[model samples]
Target: MAFTQIEDYGVIGNLETCPLIGNDGSIDWCCFPHIESSSVFAGILDDDGGGHFAIQPSGEFESAQEYVTRTNVLRTTFETDSGTMTLTDFMPVVDGVELGHTTSAIYRKVTCTEGTIELDATFEPRFDYDRVGTTVEQTSEGVIARGNGEQLYLWSPADFESSEGEEEHAEATETLRADETMWFVLQYNDREPIDAADCAALLRETIDYWQDWTHQCLDASGCPFEGPYHDDVIRSGLVLRLLMNPQTHAIAAAPTTSLPEEVGGVRNWDYRYAWIRDVSYTIQALNELGHEREARNGFDWCLTMCHKDDPGEIGHPLYGLHYPPEMVEEELDHFSGYRHSKPVRIGNAAGDQQQLDTYGELITAIYTATDYGEEIFAGEWEVIEEVIDHVSGVWTNKDKGIWEVRSEPKHVVHSKALCWAALDRGIKIAEDNDFDAPIDRWKGERDTIRETVLEEGFDEELGCFTQTFEGETVDAAALRLGSVGLLPFDDDRMQSTIDAVMDHLMTDEGLVMRYEGDDGLPGEEGAFVLCSYWLVECLALSGRVEEAHDVFESATEHLSPIGLFAEEIDPETGEHRGNFPQAFSHIGLINAVLYLNQAEPGETLDPIGRGATEITTDSKS
Candidate 1:
């Protein structure tokens, strides 16, 4: 029913929750209270039953949207025959001080900048995914929406009237001249009513808070290629931060669920839950960009969830919002899928699979944070050792692998390489800190893994590293071997794999496919953006600097106009597919840009526009 293009949206959040604001000026998707909570405004799914909040020009108009410079606050402008107006949307965020604000709120301000303009707004809420009953009432403060034992207060500075009989909907229209401003606040639950007088100040404080935080990000001074890709790097960091749950420190893969990898396909699954592997990658990226606070938070989350009595058993790959894993995959039959991609799933079944690569990811994140000057307590080190021991115990087993294919497990090459990484980092941390551990055992196991993988994962005839042990299908994951420190850039095997990947897995658009073989899923998905970045890294490392730059430019040319990217891209149409504003995609962009910035001895292209020579191995060895 709701047919909104996934790309036609920008996001604003308070680190606790986020709302997807569409180009047409509608809050189409949001989860109230918590990122994983039930949706209050899900018009992105069901147009009629699902709720929405909209502020727009009354007549036919053209609109544009963008996030404010260096901040997550979204500004949407509408131009109509009458005039033009801009709408600013953000959630109040205050740091370094307590503001006695426990309730969540969305603040919206509208300002006219041209001739007289007529603007209309609506407050429509469908609770519990439109399954629960709700009652709306007009009050002196503003309007009240009550449902599921919770209340939402709507306050406005201007004089507006609520509908009498149909209390569920609130509509208002006003004519405004240039420079005129109107304010509205929608506060969740009942605590203290927000005063209309403070609306302007609240918006200002929120803006300042975001700007201040963005400025703190490690930028041009210390970072090599900060100038050319400054905006992309900063925004990517912000998006990653937005995906982080502040209270629990868990980072979501993506906010929305069931946005298919292919239109009308069944690859839809919820990514709101935090995966250990994803969080590790996110932390590594954040730490590299001088956002150490988020990295520390991610490490602490892993400790709390994966340490102590249970310690998550090493092989478990994900954690729910709270403590235990809640990744029971189920379809939400109530709402139509995005673009009719049916069987919309709420939970990810991949959480239970034996993705052995997570141990490597977790250890790498912890070690990376240490490089950022974060201290690991003795208790945390013990947990790290436990994970390494587990990896050593099961390094030779079959796994569902990083792609989380829904078929019989196999000895994925990437999984084995990551197991080597886990042992490698564990040994490094132990040796560097002089902590107690079986160093010799870890060293032996690490070497054993390297030898096995080098022998079995590579195919001399194919001249590339295969997806699985002794297999011939080229996988994009092989491109990561050099980046992850498992192989040298100039190593013959690594170079051959790089050339083979470009030859087999690349689309004409320069995007890279995840693998050549099917993994038991129906329908075709687009080229993975992360895999494309991996190819760029491989190319840069292999002394193919100019080729890498061409590939990098080609891949980035397909980014959404505002620089956002999805999980996958339709190689044919160049359209974004899957969950939008994807964390991994942004991570890939930041890393590739950083790699190109430090690329060595290559043609000196414009510093901001081209490649860097200093390749960071992430201490994978």
Candidate 2:
């Protein structure tokens, strides 16, 4: 079996975990029960060793995949020589229900639309990342695969036969005429059989749930959901929502992990966990769409994570969905990585690294939420004060920057600017709500940080801000200094930084790389998707709407056929790299659209950063 290209997949989920269904009618990657769990199907990582669940035509056929308009439910159509058939896939989800109570089942409904077609189905289970042995037994309903102390129940009407010399595999073949339908449900732990009526009702409910959620984006007050990029904006918004756990309000960076940033390279990392910086940006984007409830829920979750027993202690850069005790990175050496990128990792080691910029990202998100009328409670205020105080004392310290570089710590300019933003926003929150705080000291520290960055973090010769203090290398992160309100978009230094980044770090495709210099990692990565969107936001706010639009189009031109983005994109071939359906990339697209919607041609717009006096509330008619 050959590995499917990363871009040839669409995702379907129940707000907890998702399965990546390939265009060729295969679920190549899936994590059972939760996004971070060991994979039940990991064919994308190792084609031969990893197990997979596939349903495709018996003979050669042409296939295409798409979403069920505005919903995460996916449909793949196969056109065979004799007939055309459609396979609709979705995970059952109940609106307003907690994750613990929702059904953890995947439903695939196959219908022949024209003539006759023969479908072959394969069910292979590899529990515990294929480390433990799995045994499958025939049952009245279908078959049960048990391994690693867990059981998977497949409820199907078609008769399945055990594969030759393979007890862990089941195969089935069926021929259907026009209008004939078949249903297959893969459930976790449960053994209750479901009829066609139950499957039909679940499908309807799932579709309605997603459509209603998408409607909220349209009905949102002050949302600019309508425009030339309306479809793209809505699609991005839905992708972000799919990564969010509806019950805990915890959002994953992406569903699958270890999808290499560079194919056949060693730049792969797991993105199943939620990052503080990524969630903060997601809140801002959702807030811009007038989804204040989701924004507030996410903010509340972040604050909960920030509560610490030790005074002035800050949380890790990222956390699991339920705030696990530890996320120790582990490699499954048995399975070859996607496209032979070795060392398929499950957990993340970067969670232990110190990323100081998280304080500013958190506080900026709090300030943005409050500006939109989300109340800040006394306890959350206490946590905010603790975070601000910590930043005040350590703003000058060197640590791992936003890129999470593994090299020696340096005075990264982006980190310093964000520290300034934290202080600035803290002072504003205290002043606005009349909350008691050390206003004078915060102001002093904030000013010192700003002056220090402007002086030491800039290169006079290059006329632009450098990646590090007195460093010569330019970084795409510099584009965010203006968006964070550390500098005005029209400031000469910021303009120079943007120009320098474009001249140095941008690809010929107009997509921006995170940085040009080394980051203590082997193998090169593709253009960072979020960085390119940052360039778009910076240009739009600087009154260069046309130029911004051009970059925005270029940045989004390589979206998956179903309108999803990965963590990075190959500038040369336009292929997706890194984790699929990255939340940060979608957030960047949504925010860029929001910024562009408010920008007046040739007129500088107010910075939509921590210092912004008002939130943009231009309603969509």
Candidate 3:
């Protein structure tokens, strides 16, 4: 059997957890309660050995799929030799609505739309990645999946005959004629697992809950981003939220990591971790679209998980979903990574690195808390001040830049600019709210960073700032100079830097490479999607609307058939690569949309790159 590509999986989830459903109606990956939880279907990891939950026609079939309008509900229809059938997948809301902290459940309804079709319904609920034996029984509660570490009730009204099966595979069959239907519900609860017979009403209620939640998203134009593509964003945002840990503020970079960008590349690693750089852009995009809660939660989660040694000791640039900075990266002993990209890791090693921008991003998020008219919790603000104080002490000494390059560290311009923003916002807080901060020290450091960039980082011959003080080559991340308000969009230096990056690092297709130097890797990879979006922002900021549109249109062409983008795009083949449905890529799409929409003169738009501090928790609203 051929395995589906990573891009082929459709996602559904509540804010707390998600499941990946292949077009063939097989759920290959799902973690209850949170993305980092033990998988119910780790088949995406082991392919043959991993367990799965599948409901598809037994015979050959034609399949077509789409998400429910403006909601994360996914519908896939299969036209089999016998008949046509449809399956709609969604999560049941706790109280028939989503507000504050909420729980989630995956509910799937299968129905026949044509002549009699013999279909199959099979669920092999594997706990802790199929590492334990499980017992099943058709209780009054539904299909109970019990294992050593966990217990869950799988509720179904489908015509299913319960039987014990092997850990790796399970099966059930149903012959349905036209207009026939079945409903399957999988409810996960620790204290009160769902115990019931028929959940048709609950299924309808869940569907209504999702539809109602979609209504809350009012785009800037007073309508949620609509059309075929709008559904994609809504679905993506919905799925990404599942990566959030509801009790905590943590949101994973991806639900699973070490799914290689290129098949057979050992670069595959776990993504169920948080990165400061990734969420910085995520906050802005989610905020612009009116998802304020998600934005605030992302920032709060980051602050709670991060810890520092002494003030001078670098705080981690990233963290695990569940633990603090010291969490050891766990490598699976049994299963190979997706497509046999071996050494599948569980925790993030990036946690211990000294990416200088994390403090800036955290501070910006704090600043955003005030800007959006939300409050950073009292305890969290104290931590924010601690981090800002640490930034104040180390603003000038460069460790790692925002890209987290493995190469030797240098005084990267973007990282330096971020430090300036940290100090700038820190001073802003001190003035606005009468918080006692080392305002003089912060201002001194901020100005020092600016003067250092102007004097040392600028390359006179190239007419732009270099990536790092000692580096001669231009980098694409320098394009953010305009966007970050380190300098104005129309400033000659900003224009030169954009042109320099475009001239040196841009591919023939206009995609941007992250840098010119070796990033501790042996060879080059695909152009980063975020960098390309930054190009569009820089283009728009400089009054190059036509050029910006050309760039934006070209980037959208890279989305997978399901209208999702990975982290990068291959330059030669134009194939999508890196993590599928990457947060950074979707965030890039939203940023580009905003920039493109603002190109018209009478829109009364604010300057996109004008004095625009890094979009943080404070900025989203």
- Candidates' C-alpha lDDT: 0.78, 0.84, 0.69
Flag clash pairs in model 1: 596-611, 596-612, 597-612, 598-612, 598-613, 598-614, 599-612, 599-613, 600-613
Per-residue C-alpha lDDT of model 3 across residues 1-621, encoded as one tens digit per residue: 346676677877776666888889988888876776777777777787666788999989888778766666788999877779999987755452334345456777888888888888887777777678877667654577777657766766554556766743335687778887777777665424443333566566656766655425444556435443455466556655555565556666777656665665655656676676666666666676667777777666556543444544334566656654434677776876677766666666666667777666666665665666666555655666777777777866767687766777788888887777777777777667767777887777777777777778788898878888987878887776556566666566777888888888788987877778766754457788888888887787677778777777777777766676677887898876666667777777777776766675322133431224343221111
Residue 577 error, candidate 2, Å:
0.1
| RMSD to native, candidate 3 | 4.8
Looking at model 3, which ten-residue stretch has the lowest summed lDDT? 612-621
Runs in model 2 deviating more than 4 A are 164-167, 216-223, 311-315, 612-621
Q: Which candidate is the best by lDDT?
A: 2
TM-score versus the correct structure, for each prediction: 0.92, 0.96, 0.86
Provide backbone clash counts, one per model: 9, 0, 12
For model 2, state the Cα shift of residue 328 in Å. Answer: 0.9
- Arrange candidates by lDDT, descending: 2, 1, 3
Q: Tell me how candidate 2 scores on lDDT.
A: 0.84
lDDT by residue for model 1 over 1-621, one digit each (tens)? 246677778998887777888888899888888777788887887777678888898889999988888888899999999899999999877764222243488988899999988988888877777778877767776677888877778887555566544337777788889999888888887546566467777777877877777635446557644666678788888888788877678888788887888988898878788888777667657767766677788878766654746434557676676556577888778777777777777778888888888888777777766766777778778877887888888999999888989989999999998888888878877877888999999889988998898889889899988999846889999876666677767767877898899899889988889998788999889999999888877777666778888888888887776678889998998888888778889888887887777676442221221111233332222
Task: Rate residue 54 of model 1 by lDDT.
Answer: 89
Error of 1 at 388 (Å): 0.7
